[model samples]
Target: MGRRGEHSKSEIECMALEAAEAIIEGEGFDALSARKVASAIGYTVGSLYFVFRNLDELIQRINGRTLDQLYAGLIEALSDCRHPQQCIYALGGGYLAFAARHPHRWRMIFEQQPRDDNLSIEIYQEKMDRLYELMEIQLKALAACPEEEVFIATRALWSGLQGVASMTIGRKPDREEEQWAQKLSRHLIGHYLAGLGTTQFNSRVNQSVGRLIDCPK
Candidate 1:
């Protein structure tokens, strides 16, 4: 067993998060528990509680880190692209690549709902918004529309990419899955952007479309 003073409180928190991530990465979220993490980190279950309020909090912490890594990956993916359309394609491919590489951790960001709804909602929403904003920037450059319309376009394109990831990335990661996801994402983005450019969507058209469907802001 790990001695009480062998690791500082912050060190224990870091160790616990690392250990929990390993457990989730290897065996999936169902295999994660406070007892499992504590044992992996060579600490008693009580030590874990000292670091995290509960397993839900630990899960949220891990998901937060996963989202950070995802954001970094997307930033790298778009670094070399020149055009706005290219950047959007880079975003989609990068997203698919990240999901393919870390299917379990990536899936956990969306699949597992937090038991502590209030805390999770506030923290996770900010991270998700950052991801959406990356796409928003490119969509705004592509479509000369009001800020409200740009926001709607961003969500619409991203929703399609998310659907592609969900359908392509199955229970197990495979080389073929990544290739398939890439092809499907490029096809969808190509057609979607083509439609966006061809359509005569302005503030008036946007307001009319908004009246028909309940779209989130």
Candidate 2:
């Protein structure tokens, strides 16, 4: 264990977050506690309290970090794809891969709730919207629909991908499980995109017919 004043408050905060994530990644979230985190970082529990309000605050910070990491993974997944449709598949693949790789941390984002009132819903929404906006851009390019339709389509597609990850991704996912997730995600995206195209085509046809019907005969 190191001396108390060796690390600054900000340094201790970063150390605590990293140590907590390592504990969760190795032993799962149930094994995490302020004592364990402090011990790992060679700090006292009181020191941790100085940096974070409580365990709830620490967990919220961890969740925020996880969101940022997940967002980076999705952006990297978009790099190789050429078309918007391909980019969406890349996003799904990237999402599932990250979930499988960090199952405990990924699950913590959805499962853990911060009890403290200091948790800002706006901050949480901003992180979530960053992830959704990636898919929204792709859907807008592919469907060329109204804003409302793009919004709904983005969520619908992500809901399907989230379901695929939730159902298939395991604590220690293997090659077969990852492949299964990829397969299901592709199938869902393929069919959903096809339906979206058809709907847009029919809408356009209806509008054209409406214009002719209103024209002088």
Candidate with top TM-score is 2
Candidate 2 global CA lDDT score: 0.86
lDDT of 2 by residue, 73-133 (tens): 9999999999888999999999999999999999998889776545947347789999999
Query: Which tens-of-lDDT digit does each residue in 1-217 have in candidate 1?
Result: 4677899999999999899889888998889999999998889999888888888888899999999999999999999999888999999999999998888898898888787789788669989999999998887776666788788888888889889999999758799999999999999999878766545444336655521112232
TM-score of each: 0.90, 0.91
The number of clashing residue pairs in each candidate reads 0, 0
The parts of candidate 2 lying over 4 Å away from their true place are 117-122, 203-217
The per-residue C-alpha lDDT of model 2 at residue 147 equals 78
The TM-score that candidate 2 achieves is: 0.91
lDDT of each: 0.85, 0.86
